[model samples]
Target: MADDYLVRIGKLIRDARQHRGWTQTQLAEALATSQSAVNRIERGNQNISLEMIARIGEALDSEIVSLGYSGPMHLRVVGGRRLSGSIDVKTSKNACVALLCASLLNKGRTVLRRVARIEEVYRLLEVLNSIGVRTRWINDGMDLEIAPPAHLDMEAIDADAARRTRSIIMFLGPLLHRLRQFKLPYAGGCDLGTRTIEPHMIALRRFGLDITATEGLYHAQVDRSIAPDRPIVLTERGDTVTENALLAAARHDGVTVIRNASSNYMVQDLCFFLEALGVRVDGIGTTTLTVHGVPAIDVDVDYSPSEDPVEAMSLLAAAVVTESELTIRRVPIEFL
Candidate 1:
């Protein structure tokens, strides 16, 4: 038990260091410790003290351990004691997934800078790598590089891996281009009410993707020859659905007009990224979008997704809870 604890902490430390783009020598300098000590800690070769852990976390700019957040469940407590410290929000769950889906378009390696190390992204990566995508944890698990494979190993897909995340739905955009026929376990994420896959279906229909839900799995069949004939109209102001439509449109060979599209932050990010990949998207930051897909995309694009607003709000809430006056930079107040 003690060894596992150190290993977890060591992993956290190593992850934080890699996330920060720091070398062991740099981390050692920050912590005022020897590089050998940092190496041993990352290797889980030595026992560390709580004071040392806190110092290491401070140097790494990560909490590493926090109250109210545990594995498996998001625990919320109504009645709580007062505090005097402050905290910053992490990142948005929505934007992270959108970016993950967007990574599938590039032929060159896609490196997501400072990705949220949440359970949600973890599940998507698991599913992505399982299907022959070369996903590497380059920097202490913070930097993610996703590379496309010549042929996907669809049978190796982790049903249990993807079923835990709603982000699995985003695979529709990437997988449609990779496989004509495939099956994925039903998506499960937050209980934020009924999030229908109907929007995804409506969006991808223009690209000839027909997905059917049967026995806790999504059976999808794609006929790539069928392209959009007319403008695709969305049913809701849904963000993910709009993104799915945008992604599908980005890869199609002709121009696709999408109506009632979400002008949400995530969709905007995805649009900007698509443009980076040489897909011309008009009416961005608006309800209507026109996408001109590339017949073949081979550009090595590098993009940094914007900061999340919800995370900024959570950080503010932390300041409120602790009754501390704190300054949270890049709060993304525009979204609020």
Candidate 2:
């Protein structure tokens, strides 16, 4: 069994090196090892340490071996088994992740109630923890408490964790207020074709954020001297883009108006969260938002995000498909 595992790891390393168009000698030079060693490692003749595997992964910019990752999950469904019970929908996954990134805006503790413990959230937590943010699970692991440090160590961010979730782009809105310049790994998630970040850049540029993507890293520079002199118009009314604009505007210390924003459920949840942080938002369920930005936020806030409409709909669909009577609770009807 151990030999089989080693062979698989070796194959993965060989494939990744080939994908990068690097020869064995080139890879050996990159790792400061001999070509023969690389050949042995790729042929499973060498017993490579975990540290060496990690170094190879970093050098190739590939996930050779995910440490805690699980294999594909399978669900065997049996017919005639009715799922009939009271189902309580958890908070919106999109909103939870957006709020998690927004927590960086607050210096004091931020407690989120009943957060969805999805893999995306876990990845973001890993990135946050790596950047000097203190996070802990409380209340039987259903609640999350995030507290930012006095100084964020941006250089110590977990690039692997950041690359696994596309939501990491939301960090730009909050991090800009804290760090003048920093580098973030490019966002990665499900393969959904080429999703451009141009809309995000167009909106963020109003707040003096200039991003240059080079070599799988976004080099971000913020000019604090620049502020929105006029109403900022969004190029695309995307939910995350609107949230990013809101995040950038949250600390502008002026009345900033955003046009063509998304009035989706997640955006509303984020607006409510911003309000809790003492940033006044004029429009809650409208496309246009006038934000009264505060120069700083350092209050401990506890917020319970509303239930996800999509989850509630999924439960309803399951009940209908199985011909079972299920009581779905906490549906955000406003969104539907």
Candidate 3:
């Protein structure tokens, strides 16, 4: 059994090396080892230490082994330890992704301070990069700078990345204004069971957006003649739904009143971001949002979304459970 496991690990290492386009000799040079030793390691003829695996992973920039337990992790807690320290709340994942989608609305450079570096954000960034948008992590990966090209290559969008995140639906709002027609992969994320995108379609249709799902893709067409003449009511108060409506409204030339909007923390963050783009949004933190749309957004903006209230609450709960006195800083008090 141990030999089989070693062989599997060896095969993974060999595959990663080949993916990096490095020969065994090159890998040996990088690892300061002989090519024969490397060949033996790859053939499972020699045992490799965890330290060597980690070095190889770093050299190839691939996670050869996760460096943690392979099975389900079990944590045994021993009570009686008081936790008495200040914890600064990180930015919210929900807000970060919403803002990533909102970045497509701006023609000028957008700098988001202390954005959450989560998988969802990374997947969105991948999709953004596959298009013509230029995204970079600055401030030591704490901040994100997004700059959209004058013309986005919708054809070049990363379908694999798009399919990994359900947030891809948020693109409909921004893309509707940019492209008369485009196709996006079907939204996919956690296996939370078959959640419907019909609510999103219902909300966005008010902005003249029509979607047809065929062959695992959403074929979207925008009717330019259609504009929101009256208040647009959302079928559901979902965060992404409210965000999609706001994205469509941001570039409209007239005022857009969105009813039944979600005033959640993430939604509020998107509203604030839209405001920074020179789109006037009234009734933030309320169900009714009055968006004074702009014809175009072309201005550099810097905005920092508030910390995650959910994380703050989790810390608070931990302190309470441990009978500890802890200071959770930068909590979004409004959300809590």
Better of 1 and 3 by TM-score: 3
Sort order, TM-score high to low: 2, 3, 1
Q: Identify the runs in model 1 with alpha carbons over 4 angstroms from their true place.
A: 1-89, 189-195, 314-325, 333-336
Count of clashing pairs, candidate 3: 0
lDDT of 1 by residue, 44-151 (tens): 888998899889878866677775745687678785555554454455567778888787777767777667778888888888888878887777876677888777
For every model shown, what is its TM-score relative to the native structure? 0.68, 0.76, 0.75
**Which tens-of-lDDT digit does each residue in 98-144 have in candidate 2?**
99999988989999999998999999999999999999999999899
Residues 1-336 of candidate 3: C-alpha lDDT, one tens digit per residue: 349888998999887776454689989999999999899888888889999999999887778987556799888978888898798999989998999899888889999999988899899999999999999989898898999999999899887788768898899999998899998877762221234577788878888898886555788999989998999988878888889999999999899999999889889989988988889999999999999999788999999987888888889889988999888888887744
Query: What is the C-alpha RMSD, rounded to one decimal, of candidate 3?
Result: 9.3
Count of clashing pairs, candidate 1 = 0
| Candidate number achieving the greatest TM-score relative to the actual structure | 2
Q: Kindly state the number of residue pairs that clash in model 2.
A: 0
Off by over 4 Å in 2: 1-83, 189-195, 320-323
The ten-residue window of minimal lDDT in model 1 covers 186-195
